[model samples]
Target: MPAITHQQALDRLAAHQLVQVIEDDVASLTSTAMSYAKHDQHLTVAGYVLPRLLARWNCVLNASNDEATPLYRDKTVLALALLLHKHGMTETAITKRALQAIDNLNAAVALSDAFFRNTDAIKALLNTPALALKKRPSTRDSLTFLRAQDVVAIQLEQYYYAAYVHEISGFNEYPIIEFYRARFEHRPDMAALQGCAAQGETYNDGKTRISLHAVCGMRHVPDPANQFHLIATGITDQPDQSQLGASVGLHTISNLFQLQGVMRKTGV
Candidate 1:
């Protein structure tokens, strides 16, 4: 049979239009979850969603040899997370019944973007979330950026950061620099960072544009037990811009890093 597009599947709800067999499976599982939810089989509903979710998660990270996959694990997981959140947060009966009908529209962002690519439609869709929240608020929430003022003068400080060299927006389109920024926001001034360059042409004011030597660095305190309470001094952000600086530090992290999803916890 001729396959149908994902759009057709959503627009028509005609199972025959499903292009990929995976889409069909998602739909079928959704239907089954709803049926179970309708009959107040909440635990069974979890049984249906969680396993499929994990299977998708495994495939997302290529942890398993699953044939079917969900590209936007953020969305699928966020939806499930949100559903579970709502189930616990609200007393409404409808959600408890329609647990399968996820409300996050952000999930569509990645899908449509992949499908349309450079189209203006992709841009528009990204800015237009059905929930209308920050697009990819994970880093913003998880990590903090520090300024020069908040620097704490103490010992035992440790450093964790990531480095990247990007092509300038209007300048060289490409530039070579082996520098890093301390993004952790817990304490800014203590980051030992000096004046950092405004990478983007986003300086609305003339002074911001003219300023040189922007403080760029990264700070991470994963386990506070080994806490670096005071600023132990960073390598690169010294007084003069003549420092070769320290080598970029990296930790072998797992895929288990928390996804800053929209699912709010209780009283959150």
Candidate 2:
């Protein structure tokens, strides 16, 4: 089957009222917990967590029962951890809760051999090539081009978040890294400012691109907890360059780390 476009995925969500259902699910789950000192605290985390969960649930629901079970289980661990953390649960407590629900986290980790194996977006991304840029385009044209790429990055971030929560076997990284690399290569100024030179670029005077290295390093981290911290830190420490660059960096790092988790689990 042909992969769905970003617009088609959005349409699917709207058609099924998927956002509302997931939002309601989060609300219902949090309703009994004490309200945050400030409501936005909960809103902030929900904003971060829901869209990804919705994407996963949408894919899982459409998949076969056998395929959905393990996907659902993996997502469940992530969802519970984020939700509990929003309610101010400590890491130790959160680990305990996840452990109690899961027979063995390591065994569950071993069930899958790849990050985002069950997500439709990953399939779509794998099939799609990096965006091709036109030379000397107008400001409007450039904006349109960047926006198109951003949509794919948005979809990738969902799966990246899922992989971060529970370790996976392998992460398919080529398409995603290529997507960002195309953008950087096309705009060396942005690339230099973001410290993400394309392969073999001498613009940085032989200093390795820190952002690029960060993504590659994720494949080596064995502990999910440490890996999670690394990813969060990367997002927070992103250079304040173009907003699009920041967004691309965020998703790119996520893809790399998830790929890393997959590598660690599968010994790749």
Candidate 3:
């Protein structure tokens, strides 16, 4: 595949669309990022390079892991850890030790899962707190609170924001349409799609337990025919606009990978 510029990736990411990084199609990108060091194109490589790649891979791996469900795969977890280390995020001794453990294929799945499931350890590695609310400062916005059920409702802020851009920009808008279409409708494989939907189902229209189904579940499917358009109807408001935006956007993609790891289990 032909290489795309950093600008292209940023545009796709900012616009809430998929870049080549997640799909297996970005072999060129992987090589390109790697080449920065060898080709002397980048000076010691900016922190963004690996983080961006890890973030993208994290999304895919997170989704895949979630779908694997009651049986989280060891290879998948370890592979992602190694990928993260390749980037520059592995600073902690705990992470280094975990990475070493994850490298062992003969390691017990239960043991590996237990290590990854350590809420405090994973949080320390990521430099984020273990509390879901503390971690989700942005998600609290655009979520309406329903007192009776202890639920949080999301009004789909990013989708609407992107849709507005699509309507106004009106340039190659079909890709944007196809993006959400795949997310809300054109589900991917059963395991992945079901996991995505299940992830979404975890949250409701309440402030306490907002769902981030969009980030993990939304699979950007290919559609040659520009058939889907943004739904002009159904818009609701949730609190924590910026936080939710960060989590849903490219910035928080890596965290999504770890979300299924410990946070879900310990309710942190």
Candidate 4:
């Protein structure tokens, strides 16, 4: 069979022109739908329709079975991350513009739950054992430019959210850095912010262009019961804080410190 172009698939879907295929081929169809869904803008069409179609594949295949291969793992993670990150955006934006896309405080909370719930691989990675590298000297020079402030600045890039802090405790940095899907929400007032303080406006102003707030910085807390405590920072106006947090937390837990990803945007 001839492969369909993205525009062709979209046009077909728009015109409700679906092709007939065998029941056994439902998985392939679902995968095709997913491919199209990736670029589709109409959530009513993509979210509602694609999920049900994907479910047809699930019904045929036993999801409980450990048939997960490397391709499966990578694809699912990326897909879930993308879906979880989606928020009616069809194009990429600068750090400022991206903030408006995912700054809804509640989104962070919702996505946090969805992210962990949707992907077992992420959970496994979080719980797995991994190694870490020794700390290196800071490369930052212009020390005078560094300001002390408590605020969570979430950077919403393409599909991910990232949080930055002025300084974190033990790690020789103040701002606790974390990345998460744009769908989730983190609270600066929660225990997560006990060691940190919020700075700038309550909501993301256009200047800082953070989702939750303008900026969030780590508060210096005395005593250290939880090593993670030092790492604790409020979920300020950052979009990717949770992803970064999960990524680093999983790395710290799984000994997988060598992982890397592209930094598409920044709140700093």
Candidate 5:
């Protein structure tokens, strides 16, 4: 990197506040997007540096401890695996960790399920977590009321933006992928995702309890032994649209990832 560019990156990382640091990234991405419009080199640089960035992020995750659902960790390693196809110059650790996450996918999910079921497991899973489980109200909607199982998923979102961008961004893209393939003309089933907020079993067209139904689902594993299933076609209206457009084309529908479009629970 040139002196000016290197200094800029340092400055961005140097912000004392978290939001400021994010602003720096947003500015950098916005600039990168503008640069990409004028030259393909910007995009090429992004692709080349993505794995290295992901690796650094995984290192950050490894520095912490969390015994709950390893979904974030799993997603992180899987993403790194996809980007890092070859083992070279100390990339072996990342590859090994990522592969291990893949091999243990089923065990991880099962453990998470068990963690939710047992009271002792729940206590063990919390490094320091805030759990909010409201009983299903009689007159109120079930969609807004998270199930007891949702405690884990809520924790998944607690440090969501900070901790698991790679996994969330990568696995969460499935809904939009299917939505596009279907021409975005109809709603798809999203309930297959189990506790997913996008699943149609949650709600209907009403704004108070809008549903994010899944239209399609498929295994997104690195290998057959590890089945990393991804479901898509749920809808939501929250996401950073400017970031999405700057990163790629604008997606009108909000899927589970809230990045692209998700399908409605009911067929159109």
Candidate 6:
């Protein structure tokens, strides 16, 4: 894989439709502050902004095509967190609002038998390590909320990277697990990667060699059979599979890895 320039990466991110959506939403949310000022009322991040953001995302998720449902839902949650933070919401408040959105969406999915008719499949999807949203501590009043916020922030970063990859790669249908596994394999030092933002190593999936960014923010566990399993939280309902070894796109891997580094260094 060849190295890309920082300008190139930023340009791609700027051109991405998801980023555009986020920017527009941020602008709109900021404009709402004017209305609050006029009414002599303080803007409520939790009670008002959060719910409105959730509703908009609910509509986005509901309107998503079946094939892109997982990607859409994951990115929507990430986008929601970004918007809330941009509006000056606290970490605790963001965690509570994000968890509420996740629960509501999961409940809605549970109600729909069409999404997963088989009980075992539904259980597998919902019980997967990646979908373990409830595992994060719910004590929003304590220091634990900070920990929860950190975990959720990392998860959101992973989702954002995945969404960026999906969009730039022309929406290829690779398994989410494999995508993260590839990311884990190419774990680059995020601090250094941010300095360049365009450098990556070529990954060979035995069949083809593709340029991939050395992104971070994914957690992994040892798998006896597969060597490693990516802990792809907040990104997909798909269970990990030993059979998936497909190669993702060049720009997909390159940009995500670089963005991960940026997120880590800036703590954004």
Candidate 5, residue 244: how far the Cα is off, in Å = 34
Q: Write the per-residue lDDT of candidate 2 for residues 1-268, one digit (tens) a residue.
A: 4454433332322222323233334443333222332445445433433443334333433344653454344434434443334333323443344344333433556333332233344334323442322221111100011111111111122222111111122332222222222221111222232443222112234442313221322222211111121222113223322422222232233333234333322201
Using TM-score as the measure, what is the rank order of every candidate, best first?
A: 6, 3, 5, 1, 2, 4
TM, every model: 0.22, 0.22, 0.26, 0.17, 0.22, 0.28
Whole-model Cα lDDT per candidate?
A: 0.28, 0.30, 0.27, 0.26, 0.28, 0.32
User: In terms of lDDT, which candidate is stronger, 2 or 5?
Assistant: 2
lDDT of 5 by residue, 4-95 (tens): 22123223222223222222222333333445545664453334334424322433345344332355555445443332221111145655
lDDT tens readout by residue for model 4, 1-268: 2232222322221112112111112223233345555577653323433343333222212223343332222323222222222211121222122222223322434234433342333323222332221221122211111222333222121222233433433444333333332221322233343333212111233332122211112222311100012223343343333222112121121100111121232212
Residue 113 of model 3, lDDT score: 44
Show where candidate 2 strays beyond 4 Å. Answer: 1-43, 70-176, 179-268
The top-ranked prediction according to TM-score is 6
Per-residue lDDT tens digits for candidate 3, residues 1-268, read 2133223322322222332222221232233344555667443332334444444343333444333431233333333333333333342443454345443432444343434344244334434321211110111111111111111111121111111111111222111110111122232222222222112112244332223321222222221011112233222222223322122232222122233332223211
C-alpha root-mean-square deviation, each candidate: 19.9, 21.1, 17.7, 22.3, 20.5, 21.0
Which predicted model would earn the best lDDT? 6
Regions of candidate 4 where Cα sits further than 4 Å from its true position: 1-151, 154-160, 164-174, 183-268
Clashing pairs in 2: 113-169, 113-170, 114-169, 114-170, 169-262, 170-262, 219-260
Q: Assess candidate 2 and give its TM-score to the true structure.
A: 0.22
Measured with C-alpha atoms, the lDDT of residue 230 in candidate 1 is 30
Candidate 3 lands at a TM-score of 0.26
Give the residue spans of candidate 3 off by over 4 A.
1-27, 34-43, 60-66, 70-73, 81-268
Q: Write the per-residue lDDT of candidate 6 for residues 14-94, one digit (tens) a residue.
A: 224454444444444444544554576665424444444433344444433642455445445444454444345434544
